[model samples]
Target: MPEAYLWDRPDGGVPIAVAASGPSSSALAGEYADGVIAVEPDAKVLELFDEAGGGGKPRFGQVAICWGPDEADCRKRVLDQWRWSPLGWKVNAELPGPDSFAAATQFVREEDLVRTVPCGPDVDKHVEAFNKYVDAGFTHVAFVQVGGESQPDFLDWAERELLPRLRT
Candidate 1:
């Protein structure tokens, strides 16, 4: 095999984060990577990572959220767009494509999505969802607003309501 090298290398190296959904991978991330990222607020992942020497390292998490004027519509939108989220990474990874995901998540209920994701215009619910990650030792938390053309509204609401509460 021929050797390959980078033509340009920066003075400051970039941080590497490993996305892990299971025990082994989480431990591996702790052992090798600069940080770990998980889709859910799973304390066990962090525990395992910390045990493997990832203590004090950045832990990033992501959650799905939907905010709108109507609570029912927001719930429906999250259910329609992100119902597949509760399937867990193993099942989500095995799916071949969007059609397969749709087929797999067809039976997912709105309440199921609500249990995991904060849906609607309630600032408290959104804050609670973000807090779950924070309480799980995650240093940084990000959210995915599941909808269309509502980014501006969401940002505004988050800035006015969510950010202040989380800061406190």
Candidate 2:
């Protein structure tokens, strides 16, 4: 009965999506799932998915960003919270756990974070970072704001400035 009820819902069935990182998983998602969720704006992954019959399906991506009133503070937040980002997917996958991640990323500096994540109040920087995903064929993108307490501020800024530019 529960299954029947779900199937009878007004909005129709919920679409299934698979989170994919590498080539095999990306192709599998194309063959088996309605969509794919990727950690980065990688065109190669999207190409693999599409070649595996995922054309026209939603391609979701997640990008990390640090936004704040001060660029220096935003960069600091990225270094403090997301220093491991520049390690690349291979290194991150090889790390066993949080402690390993901490140890592995200890040497990563603010400049590295800056190179990977758009940091600060500069709207153009954030937009440029997001556009990479779009250019990579991502139909949807989610921003992982690095600073925990600044979510509200980020949302406000996104609504006022970020979204507008992105629309055009």
Candidate 3:
């Protein structure tokens, strides 16, 4: 059976990992995966993974960020672009299509979006929010910029303001 053995990689440079949510998945990753893409900033989950994994394999996480020059615009953009994310990744992944997602999130409010996504012009808030994942042991983070546009303003702010402080 395929499960009876592992296949050799062509070059061995590929870093294989699994998306782990809790203890059982983390244990499975410990046994077979090179790292884990954790869905939340939960320290206990990472602790369980570390304890079971023999050490800390690379841990990865994502942070949803919605930004504009002002707080109200950011909130509106977050509500429009990221409202569906409140249902979490499992739901997001399983959602049948865009219309399904739209129907599901049509009634979602700015308040709801702001609760989970970091939406604002404040650089410190963004830093503080992402630090939770870093504190939770994520070795790498995906900063998801959610807005209807390219948001050059957000990117510029990130490059000029966020990156410098994050490096330190």
Candidate 4:
């Protein structure tokens, strides 16, 4: 939708480093691997892929990596973070508004392009923006929950609205 940034890890909620060994690992891996659709950041993604035991061939759909604030920071702060290449698109963009989502959709679709949309702690504020992005032809919406306080709200809204819109 908007140029929202997202970070994709093999895992889900837990940071990448610990996610592999975290408790949620198995559960995270199991949920998406069957259909192999989209992957949000955190440790869960990896868990699902590995557990599926597909021998490197995931059972789900396609795997898309999200590069949001943390992803950007990793590319900047971490050493040699560019190693995450070889994935699909490298999404990075500021919130695109000022123009209606209608215009935004036309541009991406006409150009045959996809980009990330940046989101923060504000659920109501972000959701309104998110709806616009979906209207604009955004197929996926990844919420980078950088803080503990914001995680639940952002995710709840995503599941309720954003994710449903993307599926259709």
Query: After superposition, which runs of candidate 3 have C-alpha atoms over 4 Å from their true positions?
Result: 1-10
Identify the leading candidate in terms of lDDT.
Answer: 2
In model 1, which runs have C-alpha deviations exceeding 4 angstroms?
A: 1-9
lDDT of 1 at 36: 97
51-133: candidate 4 lDDT, tens digit per residue? 55523433222222222334344233212222222222222123244343334333242112122233333334445544543
Task: Report residue 89 deviation for candidate 3 (angstroms).
Answer: 3.5
lDDT (tens digit, per residue) of candidate 1 on 1-168: 469766665678788999988889899999999999999899999999999889999999998889887889988888877889888988997899989998999899988888887888888898889988999889999988888778899899888888899899
TM-score ranking, best first:
1, 2, 3, 4
- The top-ranked prediction according to TM-score is 1
Tell me the tens digit of each residue's lDDT in model 3 across 1-168: 666988687786788888777778777877778887766787776777777772668888878888677788888877777788778766776789999999889889888877778777788888987899998888988788887474687789899998998999
Q: How far off is residue 160 in model 1, in Å?
A: 0.9
The 10-residue segment of model 2 with minimum total lDDT is: 1-10
Off by over 4 Å in 2: 1-12
- Please identify which of the two predictions, 1 or 2, would achieve the higher TM-score against the true structure: 1
Model 2 agreement with the true structure over 5-50: per-residue lDDT tens digits: 4336548567888888788988999999899998788999999999
Q: Report the error of model 4 at residue 68, Å.
A: 14
- Using TM-score as the measure, name the better of candidate 3 and candidate 4: 3
